[model samples]
Structures are given as C-alpha cells and as structure tokens.
Target: MSKKETPLFPLRKGLHTRQAHVDLPPGTFEEEHARQGFYGRTTHLYRLHPVTDWTRIEGPLRPHCYDLNPLKPSAEEAIRLSMFGSTEAGFAPICLLHNSDVALHWVAPDTMDFFYRNADGDDVYYIHAGAGKLETTFGALTYATGDYLVIPRGTTYRFLPESGDQRYLLIESFSEVTIPDRNQLGPNAIFDPAMVDTPELEPYDATPREWAVHIKREHQITKVFYPFNPLDVVGWKGDLTVWRINVKDIRPIVSARYHLPPSAHSTFIANNFVICSFLPRPFEEEEGAMRVPFFHSNIDYDEVLFYSAGHFFSRDGIGAGMMTWHPQGIHHGPHPKAIPLSRTKDRTDEVAVMVDTARPLQATPAAELMENLNYWASWK
Candidate 1:
C-alpha cells in the first residue's frame, strides 16, 4: 500500500477554509476569524531578558531587619498589619520569589489575627518563633517555633497568638503543596503515619464573620474586590477543612546500624517535587554522627533551602530569613569547616525547609529582586 499525502499545514490550511460567505454578519467574520492563522498551534512564551535577571521586574520593594528582636515594637506591629492586609499590608516587608506565586511573609511578635484562605493557591506557614493556637475545623492545634503548618487549598483558618508573642515565615506556594516523596528512602520510610502528630480538633461557637474575595481577570492587571464572607459555609466535612501537624512529631527513620542519608528524614510530597526538613536530631549510626548535611549535588531536582533558626554550619553567611537556591549544577554542601565541626556533635539544633523540584522552576521578576543575586553562580 502507498502512503497518503499529508497536507503541508494540517490545522490552518487543511482543516478549515477561509472563504467569505454572504450570509455572515458584516463585522462578525472579521472579529472572530481575523487571527485564524495561528489557531490550533502550540506557542512558546519567550522572555526578552535572561532568566536570572532580578532587576527585570519591579525592583526590591523595601528592606527591614530580618532578625527577630523580642523588644522591637515595630516588629509586632508588622504582624498585625499583615493579618489585616494582603502582602501589600505595610507591616514588615514581604520578600517574594521572582515568581509572585511564592512569597515569604515575615510576621513579628504579638502579631496574630492573620485569617485567610487561598482562593488561587496553597500557603504553608513555617513558625519561626513564639507559640500559638491554630483554630481549624478539625480542631485547635498548638504550634510552637520550628513548626510547619499547611493550610490546604481553600481551607479557612485563623491564627490566635499566645501571650509570648510570635514571628513566622509564611511560605505561600501558590501551587498545590504536599509532602516530599520518600523514594530515596525506599517505601514509606520518611514521615510515617505514626510519626506525624495530627492535632486534636477543638469545637467553638461564635457568630459567623464575613470575608473578602478577590478575583483576577484575564489580560487585566487589577484586583477585583468582591465583598463576600467565604465563611458562609455553616458546616464542612472531609479533609477539605483546616488541620495542623507538628514537624517534631515527624520522627526521622534512621538506619539502625549504618549511616543513613539525608533523604531519610523527608516528610512531604508535591506534584513535581518534595519538601524535606533538615531538623535537629541525633544520628542513627555510629556513636557520633555528623549532625550537619554533607556537601553533595542534587542531580534530580533544584534544591531551595530557607533558613529559619539555629546556625547553618554549611554556609557561613546564612542566617534566619535567608533563602538559598541551589539549582541543578555544581555541588552544595556545608562549608568545609562544618563537616569537621558537625562530626563532634551527636545532634543538631538547626531547622530548615528544603524544596526539591524535579523540573526547573521559573522565577518571576519579584523573586529575582528579593534574591541574593550574587549567590546565583557562587558555587562555581
């Protein structure tokens, strides 16, 4: 049998004819069919500047002291401001990724009352300091410093700060966020069900309040404010509601007799990547195990680590509120000094979140501006 001849332009020329018909309305044909040449085709959206150009978008908004000073009154006020306003709320400045989808919100002491639900994306709150009660449908979860709370998509909740005062690094993923996969640790090794502490549900009764919903339109760069309280749902069921889990409860599954790898402690998973916490804990093997991460290269995904508290031995310049992105390239590990120092200690006090993406992540101009651009190619 002979092969049939395929049309040169399958979608535009072969599929549809562009003949003018007298029956059509005078302006309808032009309005609808004017740009038919590019129909049914895939296009690549291109950027004019280099991907690492941090100044390509709005420059850095404002800079504030990232450190937490318990005596600072302005720090607490910033928390109150963010609770009432969006990222625009002028409390402490929020540093966002080049892509606006991900943002790090800094909230200070006595700064509670951040009640919000993600209408567009998911948000994960990493407790940087203080203790508080998270009121959710499932119940009330008491969280302290170094804890991670994930408010799933559309899950409504409120933050009730305790008397001690608090600070937090709000990580708004803007995409569905989940526990990092445990493939590296074999089956169900990391974040086992028993290790995660699901908070007890608390019941409360009060007059329902209203909330504001903002909608973004296509091609329009403004926010449309709709005055409607989403809490209208008198009741809810299923896991769609609010919940909290303590990062401490996620016990690390270490090798009994042998030295376990860093992947042994991962706890969550997402679509294309996983999130791991390099927490403070004792090593599983040998009388003394290096508490700090060793130098290594991530061939699988781009690794982005956010330092919350404690000293990061690997990197000298790193401190709380600092973010480091180690894309797939050269090796990144603790500073040469850290390896020898960590070996002496049986455990560590460090707390950090590591995000590994199997695919390359695109940064919005916002992220580039907040990033320490000098660190882009520093590993080399």
Candidate 2:
C-alpha cells in the first residue's frame, strides 16, 4: 500500500455507526478525550442501567503513591523481569505501572470462580501466552496467544483459562481504546480492518455452579451473587463489545529509507496513552539510514515496551515476557552493540507492544520488586 492512498471518510451522526442497537439501551454514550476539544476519536458504549443497582461499599480508598524514585545502580546494567506465572486465585493480577489515566497489570489467574466488572475504566488485555474463553455479558470471546482483547468499562466478564500456564499484559484505561483513524494514517494502513476480530454474538446461557459477579469501583471490590448466569444478553447490536486483534495479523508500516516514528505502529489510543505494536518489518536499507531508534529522552511521555515474541536484538537480555520501562525525564536508546549489528541486518522479527503515556507513570510495588535496581548503569 502506498503511503498516499486514502480511505473514504464520511461524517457520521445519528442512530448508529457500523452496527445497530435495540431497546433504546439505557447505556448513555460518553467520550473522554485526551485533548479537551472534539479532536480525538471516541468509544461508543451502553450501560443497561444508567444510574441504578450500583452500590458502593467502601472502607477507605486504597492508598497509592508514585512520588519517589529509587536511585539507580551506578555500576549496574539493564535487567529484565518475568511477569509470568499465577498467584493466589483471588489475588491474581500483579499491578505494575499506574497513574490517573491508566493502570497496567500482569495477571495469570489459575481459576476464576467469580465474574468481574471494572467500573473505573475499560481494559485491553494483551495475551502474551494463553488460550481461553472470555465469558461476558455481550458474548463469549475466545482468546489465545497474541490476541489483543478490548473489553469496555462496565462489562462483566470472567476468564476461563484453558491452559495451566497463562500470562497477560492488562492495560486498564480510564478512557476508551479506539483504533487510530485511517485518515490519519493515509494509505499507510496496510493492516485491513477485516483482520480485527469482533465477537460473533454467541450468547452464553449456561448455568454455572457458582454464579457470582464482582464489581470493582474506586479500587475496591464488591461481590454480588446470582442463582443463574449473568451473561444473559440474548441480542446486542452495537459497536461496543469485546474486540480482539492478534499481532500476527497486524501488518506494520515500514520504511526502508527514513525510520518511522512509533505512531506509525499505533494500534489503540486511549486518553493519556497510546498502544503501538512493533512487529516483523524490513530494516532501513538506505545507505546511512539509522536502522534502529535514535537516542532520545522521554521528555513528554513515559515509555514501556513489553517484549512479546521473536528475537529483539536492539536490547541485550530482553526476551519474550519481559518489559522495559523508561519513565519520563529519562533518556534511553538502542544498545551500543545493536547499532553496528543493524548495519548488516536486512529485517527484524521483533514483536513488542509499547505503551506511551502522556502522564508520568509510577512503578507499583510488585513491579519494583522485579526491577533491575542497577538498570540505569547499562548505558555506561
């Protein structure tokens, strides 16, 4: 696809877009923007009950702090941590980086006896390794390795993992996660919309042994029990539902002359953060073209790269299932060895998902434990 090709852009207003809705759903649509004005795209959603049935049982808001940064190891080198494996059943997802706009988690739940609903925001689950079925009010979404699952806020769902060893990178966005506008990419959208996998509307009516739904609001959890399954929605015709997109199907836009910015690989955009994919692509072939990313500072954004698959030669010791975080105000670039190595490399099979947040992100307690205390000395 040429970079100059364009797609049809039509101004849409009114009853529905792409899909239709029935019963005049009580769920009101809201648009939370990164920029205050009507510039960025909005996510369409519906709530069965606008303002009812939600009881907030609270003791005290969970105390969270990201104000301090532990000094880096002067003589230490860059290190990687494995966020794989499962913890206690109830205490699954290990919190990693978090801020007002987003909360990132690495989870490997052994079993889910109860469903969960996040009233705070929507969730994007990047399956690092796992195969499972996500039972939600909208429908059942079968997920596997490399699937990027987007579940809207207020949606109740439970993960039924089919594999004993499951790992996931879950991004809780306080705002919606939408695809970058095709217009912005011009003709660079080599990945077709058909590659995206939406639910097939297969409603689940099974009667589970334990029918309990857990609602999470304000970082607190409350459980509601039901005699029957809660995924009883027989029909829903709206653009809102669980969505999946595998990295394997995403065709990255690459340039052999001028290295493209991360935005060229933008997969999903949120309020203060944007998710991008770094899949297999040809290296810059131009005689002196910088094949790897140039050294730079995270002046305006906190950058996180979650290594997914393949060999990422740019960074030493970084392997699949590891994450590298360069907080705002820090400067980082490719390893010295990677530069010379790129000279002869014609292509790269690296697969990674990057989260670039506008707001400074703080590492959580769990994430801090897995940190390379001396990672700051790697550049030396």
Reference-based lDDT, each prediction: 0.50, 0.68
Best by TM-score: 2
Q: Count the backbone clashes (under 3 Å) in each candidate.
A: 17, 1
TM-score of candidate 2 to 2 decimals: 0.75
TM-score, per-candidate, Cα-based: 0.60, 0.75
**Candidate 1's error at 336, in angstroms?**
1.5
Query: What does each candidate score in C-alpha RMSD?
Result: 16.8, 16.9
Candidate 2 on 245-327: residue-level lDDT in tens?
A: 88888888877666666777889998878999999999978774557764444456778888888888677666787788876
